[model samples]
Target chain A: MRIVVLAGGIGGARFLRGLKSAVPDADITVIGNTGDDIHLFGLKVCPDLDTVMYTLGGGINEDQGWGRTDESFTVKEELAAYGVGPTWFGLGDRDFATHIVRTQMLGAGYPLSAVTEALCDRWQPGVRLLPMSDDRVETHIAITEAGTGERRVIHFQEYWVRLRASVDAEAVVPVGAEQAKPAPGVLEAIAAADVIVFPPSNPVVSVGTILAVPGIREAIAAADAPVVGLSPIVGGAPVRGMADKVLAAVGVESTAAAVALHYGTELLDGWLVDTSDADAVAVVEAAGITCRAVPLMMTDPEATAEMARAALDLAEASR
Target chain B: MRIVVLAGGIGGARFLRGLKSAVPDADITVIGNTGDDIHLFGLKVCPDLDTVMYTLGGGINEDQGWGRTDESFTVKEELAAYGVGPTWFGLGDRDFATHIVRTQMLGAGYPLSAVTEALCDRWQPGVRLLPMSDDRVETHIAITEAGTGERRVIHFQEYWVRLRASVDAEAVVPVGAEQAKPAPGVLEAIAAADVIVFPPSNPVVSVGTILAVPGIREAIAAADAPVVGLSPIVGGAPVRGMADKVLAAVGVESTAAAVALHYGTELLDGWLVDTSDADAVAVVEAAGITCRAVPLMMTDPEATAEMARAALDLAEASR
Candidate 1:
């Protein structure tokens, strides 16, 4: 089976790990979300793409689910001593090599897609990892300061990683998504996929930003493959990350059914809500999508593989 | 007293440490050679300038006389694992931070001189360090492959560090020197100096490259200050490094007197030869330059400081 997965950072990476475990023989092509990509210390950092690459290649910090295991922060500490910052963004020595190589390639006139391919040459991440779009697409968050009531726009990382999404997000904008065409193989991958899975990644900035790229959503909507989504939101809250904050920015309720509806009937063919929110399955099915309630919590490898197995079954059922 | 010194890498840095010990109150300005600066992994590696900074700032690896004192090679190892390298260069994790910060600053439009000064803010290397030229002036070595008989030009670093100067250097060319202008304050530092000294650095590549910058040699020649130089060549070979190979490339003999004549009477007022080269003192003085034979071995701090003191005394006598 040829599977297509649109991934974000840790959560999406974790889900893809399960997907790989569930079907080791399957040929997976990942369309990683690059909207979270940021330029730190003049190096292009693709957080989600790296997370997936590191996670699958076994370089990942299994505990944190991102960056390299046994990573040292000597470079970071030295940089801080030099007083060159956004010291808030923690880039370890091992992780720095990835960004440095990517930045160097980009500077040498390679697009992000080519750079991603070149980097993957090292990791052999077991999947053809394609960035959502080769063109720059940064997700920015509009937030109101809690004390000052001042409205300001900041990069998604500052809001998510730095601010911890403490202030209410007024809006989430994928700045260059409207102008960005899908990276070369994205549309073809979707069209050729036996099944496409959205792996409980953030609705607004992760998977949503991937869909926002011009032609990507249209390609998926037109694709014959069943588009199965495992809800990032389970019961009344997110299983991980601050998804509820950005979900509110898009005026979507923090519920399993609501997230499925937000993706909507046109783009989605199958929706899987957690067993805790089993009632959401009927609500999602009422919206003309084939729905299932599964144990969606990716607690362990076996559990996550089961989630992957459930999604594949739903794809078959919906088809 | 205001002093100006033309410097290279390890040898120059070690001499400066002694000069600081010798003249604790002198205002010293260093004109560091940048001809050996090379772009490795897309980051500017200013080897000589960094050597001067790290050595004076108490961060140098004491054994090696370059790089950080306590450094890890995680970044370098990771880069090698990715098979993205000229792995021979060996930039440690701490040193990578310096290059990253410099590359970012330079990319943001800061001139090489300004970037050096800013970097000094962290190192507090005491002496004012300025690159020989703000413009790129890479030194290239012309060599013939022994077995293949193929003549090719390689970077100065490739010739020095990687090849260890194993092959006879056909020619040493400061590629952009003819077009390059002195960095800001370099000429002023020379002109305002009470005394100027050339450390026992690579005369062909280090001090020679600095003088190659269009106006620097002219400024030194026209300056009222007494200009003195310590011979990198002691009796018949260079004190350190492959100065002999490059000296031969320039058609100069690897001897103290020959090197003194290479910098001529117009540019040099005084010359210091090691006690072993006492006979060469007469040979150098015959060329209208005052010469002294001294214990020039920089075995330790006190010994090196005495050498610095002798050079100062010669400068005073010449003046």
Candidate 2:
């Protein structure tokens, strides 16, 4: 079976690991959101892309879920000594090499799609990894300062690393999404997919950014394959990440039913919620999307694969 | 007395250490050549400037004479895994951080001079070290391949690291030198110096490239101070580095007398030759440059300090 997955970082990477284990024979194509990509020390860092690459390549720090295992900070220290800017982000020496290669290739005129393919040549992630688009789509968050009435838009990393999401987000904008075309393989993968699954990833900033690209959401909606979304929220809170904060910016309630309704039955054929939010299933089903309750905690690969199977099963039952 | 010295890499760094020991109270300024600078993995690396900084700041590898001590290669390994360019040069994880910071600063619109100042703030290399110019002046070598009749201009790193001076250089050019201006404080340091000493560094590539800048050679010749050059070639071999091959490129013989004659007495008031080449002292003196024979081997700090003192004494005697 050909499966297409839209993913973010840690949560998505972990869930995909399980998905791979669950559907061993399925050919998976992942369209990763590059909205969180940041240029630091002249190297382009694609956080979500690297997270997925490392996780699938078996090089990820299982505990941190980001960066490589047994990483060293020698390069970071040297950069600090040189008084380089944006020292707040913890860019490990080993992690830096990935950015270096990606940046070099990008500077050499290769599109992000081609660069990702080149990086993946060595990583050999079982699934094909495609960036949402080759165009620059930066995620910017608008926040009002405590003392001032003026609002400002900050880069996603500034919001995540520096601010630590302390303030209320007025709005979250994917800057270039209006003009970004889906990478060449994105629409085709969605059109040919047997089942399309949205992992328990940040809806507003992660999967939403991927959907915002021109032609991607429309293609997924028109596909003959079943499209199912796993709610990132469980028990009225996000399982991980600051999804609730961003969801508030987009004015979406942090509830399993609300998130399912947000994606809508027009594009989504099935919606899977955590067992903790089993009561929300009736509300989603009433909204015209087939809903199922599953143990959504992706604490291990086995549990995640089961969650993946549940989404696939929900799509089959809906048909 | 204020002193300004022209420097290259390892040998120059070692000599500066001794010069510092010899005159601890003297305000010393080092004008470093940037022709050896290479952009590797999107980071600008000024080898001569770094060698001087690391040596004086007490961060240099005493045994290797370059790079940080106890350095790790995790970054390089990661870079190699990603198949980045220029894997031949030994850029350690700790060393990469320096390049990263420098590249970031350069990308942020800061001139190389200001960037050097910021880097020096952390290193605090007691002596003022300035690159010859903030402009990008890369040294290229014209070499003919054994199998091909065509000659190609290769970056200095390709010649130094990959070829290891195995090929015959048809010509050596310091690109961007024609329009390059002397770095700030370079001319002032030269004009205000009580004595000027050229360390036993590669003459053609290091000191020669520094002089290639528009106003630097003129400033040295016009200065009221006595200009002295210590021969890098002692007993018909370079103290360190591939000086002989470079000398051959410029059609200059690799000998204490030949190098001194190459500089000419019009620019140099005093010339120091190794005691091993005592016979060459008369030949250098005959050219109207004051000549002194001394044991120029920097076997240890004490011996090198004595060499510095001897050069100072010659400057005083000539004045």
Candidate 3:
């Protein structure tokens, strides 16, 4: 089977690992989210793309589910000592090489897509990883200050990594998405895909940002393959990360039925909620979408694989 | 006293330490060699400038006399793992920060001289450190390969660090130095100096490259200050490094008197040779240059400081 997955960072990477495990022979093409991509210390950092690459390539910090294993923060510390930093990002030495390589290649006139391919040449992530768009697109978050009540915008990383999403997000904007076209082979991948899956990633920033690119959403909707997704939200809470924070910025409730309705029947053919949120299945089916309730917690690889398998089964059923 | 010193890598850095100890209150301005600067992995690597900065800032790897003190090669190792390298360079994790900061600043349109000043803000090396020029100038060594006998011009770092100057150097070229103008403050520093000293650094690549910058040599020669130099060559060989290899390329014998003659009386008012090369005193003095024999070994800080004091004393005598 030829599969296409729209993914985010840690959660999306882990889901793809499970999907790869569940369908070993399937040719997977990952449309990685670049909304969270940041430039720190003048080096380009693609958090989502790297997460998927390292996870599948077996270089990931398995405990944390992102970045390289045995990573050191020597570079980060030294940069801090030099008083040059955002210092809040957990950019380890091993992770830094990727950024350096990527930045170097980008500076040399290679587009981000080509640079991603060059980097993947080392990792051999087993999936054709294409960034959603090579054009510069950054997610920014507007947050209100506690004491001053001052509204200010900052990079998504500052909101997520630095602020830990503690403050309420007033707005989440993908700064350049309207101007970006889907990367080369993205529309073709969707057109050629036998199965299109949306792993339990942040709908607002991950898969949502990918769809925000001019033709990507239209291509997927027009694709002959069934579009299936698993709920990142279970029992009115996120499986991991602060998905609720961003979802709220888009005025979406932190519930499986609400999220499914947010993607809507036009984009999603099949939607799977966790067994605990079985009530969401009927609510989602009421919206003219095929829905199922399964155990969605990625507690282990086997459990996550079972979840992936269920999504694939739902795709077949929806078709 | 206002003192100006032309410098190279490790030897220059060590000598500067002694110079600082010898005249703690002296207004010292160091004209650091930029010929040794190269782009490695697309990052600006100013090996000589970094050595001096780290040494004076108390961050140098004391044992190796270059790179960061408590350095790790995690970034280097990771870069190697990605197979993106000229893996021969000994860029440590902490040391990489300096380059990253420099490269970033340079990319953002800061001149190298300004970048150096900004970097010095953290190091506080206690001297005004300026590059010979704001423009790029890389020292390349022409050598014949062992088997193919194919002659090629490789970067100075490749010849010195990677090849260890194993093969004979056929030619030494300071690429881009011809068109380079002296960086701001370089000529002014020379003209304003009470005494000018050339520390025991590589004659060809270090001090030679600096002088190659347009108008700098002329500025030093026209300056009113007594210009004195300590020979990096001790007896008939270099005190350290493969200065002899490059010296031969320039058709200058690796002898204290020969190096002095190469600079000539036009440039030098006084010259200091190692006591072992005491016989060279007559040869250098006969060339219309004041010459002295001194213990030139930088075996320890005290010994090195004594050498610096002797050079200063010679400057006074020549005046």
Candidate 4:
């Protein structure tokens, strides 16, 4: 089967690792979310793309599920010593090389898609990885300071990494999404896939941001294949990351049913929720999308592969 | 007395360290050669400026006389793993931070001089550190590849570090020097100085490259202060670095008197040669520049301090 997966950062990367393990023969196309891409120390850092690349390429810190294994912080320490920062973002020496190569290629006039392909040449992530768009699309969060009641917009990374998402995100906005065209092969991948799966990633920032790219949503909605989504919110909370904060910003309840409803029947055909959120299946089914409950905690590759298998089964059943 | 020194890399940096010890209270302004600066892995690497900063700031690797002490090469190793290279350039993780900060500032539209000032704010090298030009000025060496005999120009760093100056440099060209204006504060420092010294840095690439800047040599020549130069050649050989290779490229002999003659009497008022090259003193003086012989080996800070003192003494006697 030719499968397509929309990935975010840690959670999505972990799920993709499992999906690869489950169906080794399947040709996979990963449309990585680039909204979380940031310029730190003047180098382009695509956190989500790197996470997916490293996880699948066997270079990821398995325990952290993001960044490189055996990473060193000498570069970060030296940068801080020079008083240059957004020091809150943890970029290690090994991870810095990825950004350096990306930035160098980007500076030399290669589109993000070409750069992604070039970077993947080294990682050989076993999938054709494409950024959601070649053009820049940054996710900026609108937040009001608690101490001063001052309102300001900050980059998604600053919101998540620096502030730890403590302040309530008033609005989650993908700044350049409306105008962004799908990267070169994105629409083709969606049209050609036997099944498209939204891995257990942040709905508002990850998959949602990818859909926000103008032609991508229309392509998936119009695709012949059934589209399936695994709920990032296992029960009433996110499996990892502070997805609840951004979810609330978009007026969605932090529940499997609400997340499925947010994606809607027009775009989604099947939804998978954790066994704890079994009550959400009927609610989602009533809304016209086929829903299934499964053991969704991606505790290990075996557990994640099972979740991948369940999502694929749901997609097959919907067909 | 206020002193202005035109410096290259290791030799100049070592001399500055000695000068600081020689005259602890004298205000010093160092015009660092920028022609040797190269962009590696998308980061600006200023070899001369960094050498002076690290050496004086007490952060230099004493053995290498350049780069940071207690450095790690994780970033370099990782870059090589990604197959992004000019792997010959040895930039340590700690040293990478300086380039990152510099490149970031340059990208943000700050001039190279301003970026140098910003970098020096952390180093507190005591002396004012100024790049010879805010504009890009690279020293490209014309070399005939030994095996291929392909005549092409390569960056000075590649010539120095990668080839180790084994190939004969046909010509030494400061690529952008003709149009490059003196960086801010360079002429001002020269004009206000009580005396000027050329530390035994490479005449052809170091002090020569600095003089290649449009207004710098003219400023020093017109200034009231006497300009004294210490010959890098001790007896018949360069004390450090392959000054002989570039000197040959510039059509100058690798001798103490020949180097003094290369600078010429029009710009240089006094010259200091090593006691071992005492026989060349009268030959240099015949060229219309006052000449003196002194023990010039920078074996220790004390020895280098005496050389700095000897150069200052020459400047005084000539005045």
Candidate 5:
């Protein structure tokens, strides 16, 4: 099977782990969200891409679902000692290698796509991981400080990591997305995909940011492949992350049916929500997107694999 | 008293430590060699300046005579794991922070001299540390590669660290030295100094690289101060490093008299050699340079301080 999946960080990585387990032989193309990429200490850090790479390549910290397993914080600690930091973003010693290599390659004139390929060579992630764009497209959140009451826009990392998404997001903007061309092979992967999946990633910032790329959303809409999406929301709250806060920023309700409607029948043919959200299946189907309710809690690889299998089944049903 | 010393890496750092102890209350200005600075992994690694700072700041590894006292190689190991390396140079995790800070400051448009001063504000090396130039002027060694017989120029770090100076250095070239202007305070320090000293650093690459700056050499020659130098050679061999190898590159022998003669009477007023090189005193004196044989081996801080005192005494005698 040739499958293309749009992925964010942790939740998406966990779903990818399950997808790989479900179809070990599938030729997977992961269009990793690059909006979370930030330059820390002058090193380019791609959190989402690294998460997917580490998760699939068996190097991810299973407890955290992000960064490398057995990682040390010597580099970060030393950087802090030198008073150089965005100290809130924990970049471990092992994880830093990825950014160093990526940044070095980027500085040497290799585009982010080629650098991603080079990094994946070491991880052997088994899936082709392409960043949404070679061009810079940072996701920034418009927020007001709870105590200071100062309202301003901050980079997505500062909003997510430093602020911990404590305040409501007024707007989530992908700064350079309108000018960004899909990284090499992204549009091709969408067109060649037998089935396209949006794993359990934040709709407003993760998969939403990927779609923000100028050519990507249009390419997937025109492709012959059936587009399937899994709800990051379980019941009424996010399975992981502050997806609801960002969902509200874009005027979408944090519900399975609303998420399906947010993607819309024009693009999405299938939607998968948790079994607890079964009643919303009819609501989504009423809007023309084929909906299925499955056990969406990724408690383990097997349970997550079952979720992936259900999403593929929905894709077939839509066809 | 205002004193200026030109320095290299380990040898110069060790000498500066002694100089600080010898003249505890004297205002000292060090014109550190930047020729050995190299960009490794896209980070500017200033080995010489760092050596002086760390050695004097109580953070240097006493046994290794370089890098932090309690250092970790996690960053370097991780970089190597990514196959991104010139792995021979041992840059510890703590050492990496200095480079990261420096590279960031340079990227942000701060000149290298300003960056060095800011770094020293933290190290408090007890003496003013100024890079010889704000501009890039890497010391390149021309040599024939072993086995391959490739005659080419390689960075001084590659020559010293990777090649181990096992191959003969045909020529030592400070690539951009000719056009480079001395850093803001370097010429002024030389002009205003009561005395000037050349520590027992490599003449061809370390102190020699500093003198390669056009107006700097002219400035020191015309300075009112008596210019004295301590020979890096003892019993016709380098006290440390492959000073002999690079000295051979410039057709100078690794003897106290030869080194003093190479500096010439036109600029050098006094020369200090090790007690074991007492025989060279007559030869150096014959060349119209005042010569003294002192215990130049910096066995400890006290011994090094004594050597510094002797160098000052020679400066006094020359005056």
Candidate 6:
């Protein structure tokens, strides 16, 4: 089966690792979100893409679920000594080189999509990793300050990292989404996919940003493929990340049913909710999308592969 | 006495350590050559300036004559894994961070002089280190291929790090020199100096590149200061580096007298040669410049300081 999985960072990377194990023969094409990309110390760091790449390439620090294993901080310390900006992001020395190479190639006139392919050439994640678009689409969060009524837009990292999502988010906007065209192979992959699975990633920022690009949602809806989404919310709380805070910014409740309804039956043919969210299945199925209750915890690769199997099973049933 | 020193990398850095010890109170400003600077992996690397900084800051690796004492290479290995470009240069993980910070600051519209000041804030080299210019001025060397008569210009790093300067140099050109301006404080430092000393640095590439800046040479000559140069060549050979090879490219002999005549008394008031070239003193003096024969070996800091003092004494005598 040709499966195209839309993903974010940690959870997505882990889930993809499982998917690879679950369906080794399945041609997987991952449409990774670049909304969290930041230019730190003159290197373009794509947090989501690297997370997926490293995790699948077996180089990720399994404990942190971000950055590479056995990474050093010599470069980071030198940068701090020079008083360089944005020292809070924790970019490890080994991690920095990846960004450097990516930024260099991008500066030399290669689109991000092409750069991703070149970077993936060595990783050989067994899945074709494609950035949602070649054009820049930064996710900005509109937040109300502690003392002010005015809502201001901040870069996703500033919102997620610097602020730690402390402020009240009014809205989340993906800047440049209006003009961003899907990457060269993105639309084709979505249209030709036999199964389109949305990993348990942040809906408001990860998969949402991918769907925000022009014509991507339309292509998926029009595809003959069975579209399935796994719930990132278990028992009304996110597996990781500040998904609830972002979901609140978009007026969506932190529940499996709410996320399914947010994506709607227009694009999704099947939905997989955690066993803890078994009660949400009826509400989601009432909206004309097939629903299943499965053990969705990705505590290990085996568990994650089982989750991946559940997603495929849901797609198969709906088909 | 105020002094301006033209410098290159390791040797220049080591010599400056002694110069500082010799004249503890003399106001010294180092005009570092930016010709050796290269943008590797999207980070601006000022190798010469860094050598000076690390050496004076007491963070230099005494054995390697470059990089930090406790440096690591996690970043470099990671970069190689990613198949990034230009892996030949000894860029340690800690060193990469310095370049990243510098490149980011440069991209943010800060002049290199100001950035150098900020970087020096931490190093506290005591001597003010200024780049030749804020603009890009790369040194390109023309080399004849062994198999073919075709000659091509390559960046200084490629010539030095990759080829180890093994090829016959046809010509050495500092690209962008015509349009490049002397970095801020460069002219002022020269003008305000009691004496200007050229440390036993590479005369052709290091010191030559500093003088190549539009107004620097003229400023030193117009200033009410004595300009003295210590020969990089001793016993008819360069103390370090292939200075003779590059000297040949510029049509100048590697002899101390030939180097003195190349600079001329038009810009220099005094010149210092080693005891081995004591006989050449009259030849250099005939050019209207005071010449001194000193034990110009900087085998240790005390000896280097003695050499620095000799240059100052010659400058005062000429005045």
Residue range B1-319, candidate 4, lDDT tens digits: 8899999999999999999999999999999999999999888999999999999998999998888899999989888988889899999999999999999999999999999999999999999999999999999999999999799999999999999999999999999999899998999999999999998999989999999998898898899999999999997899988999999998999999999999988789999988999999899888899999999999999999998988888899999
Query: What TM-score applies to chain A of candidate 5?
Result: 0.99
- The best-first sequence of candidates by DockQ reads 4, 1, 3, 6, 2, 5
What does the interface RMSD come to for each candidate?
0.5, 1.3, 0.9, 0.7, 1.2, 1.3
Instruction: Please identify model 6 stretches exceeding 4 Å from their true place.
Output: A147-151
Give the fraction of reference interface contacts each candidate recovers: 0.84, 0.98, 0.84, 0.94, 0.65, 1.00
Deviation in angstroms for B206 in model 2? Answer: 0.7
Q: Write the per-residue lDDT of candidate 3 for residues B4-105, one digit (tens) a residue.
A: 999998999999999999999999999999999999888998999999999998889999999988888998988998888888888998989999999989
Quote model 6's TM-score for chain B.
Answer: 0.97
lDDT of 1 at A141: 97
Tens digit per residue, CA lDDT, model 6, A112-217 = 9999999888888889999998988899998887777766888999999898888877889899988999999999999889999999999989999999998999
lDDT for each residue of candidate 5 in B38-91, tens digit (9 for 90 to 100): 999888999999999999989899999989988888889878877888889999
lDDT of 1 by residue, A1-319 (tens): 9999999999988998899999999999999999999999989999999999999898999998888999899999999999999988989999999999999999999999999999899899999999999999999999988889888999999998899999889999999999998999999999999999999999889999999998999989999999999999987899999999999999999999999999998989999999899999789999998998889888998899999999999999999
> What is the alpha-carbon lDDT of model 1 when measured against the actual structure?
0.94
Clashing pairs in 5: none
TM-score of each: 0.99, 0.96, 0.98, 0.99, 0.99, 0.96
Model 5 chain A is weakest, by summed lDDT over 10 consecutive residues, at A77-86
TM-score of 2: 0.96
- The runs of at least 3 residues in candidate 2 whose Cα sits more than 4 Å from the true structure, single-residue gaps closed, are A146-151, B146-151
For residues A1-319, what per-residue lDDT tens digits would candidate 2 score against the true structure?
A: 9999999999989999998999888999999999999888878899999999999999999988899999988878777666666778988888888988888788889999999999899989999999999999999999987688788999988998888888988899999999999998999999999889889999988999999999998998899999998999999999988889999998899999999999998789999999999999999999999998999998888888899999899889876
In model 1, which residue pairs have backbone atoms overlapping below 3 Å?
Answer: none
Deviation (Å) of B186 in candidate 4: 1.3
Candidate 2: TM-score of chain A is 0.98
| Displacement of the residue B213 alpha carbon in candidate 3, Å | 0.3
What clash count does candidate 6 reach? 0
List model 2 lDDT by residue over B1-319, tens digit each.
9999999889899999999999999999999999999988867999989999999999899998999888899989988888776779999887887887788789889999888888889989999999999999999999987678778899987998899988887788999988999988999999999998888988888999999999999999999999888899999999887889889999999999999999887689998999999999999999898999999999999999999999899999888
CA-lDDT, candidates in order: 0.94, 0.90, 0.94, 0.94, 0.92, 0.88
Error of 2 at A265 (Å): 1.7
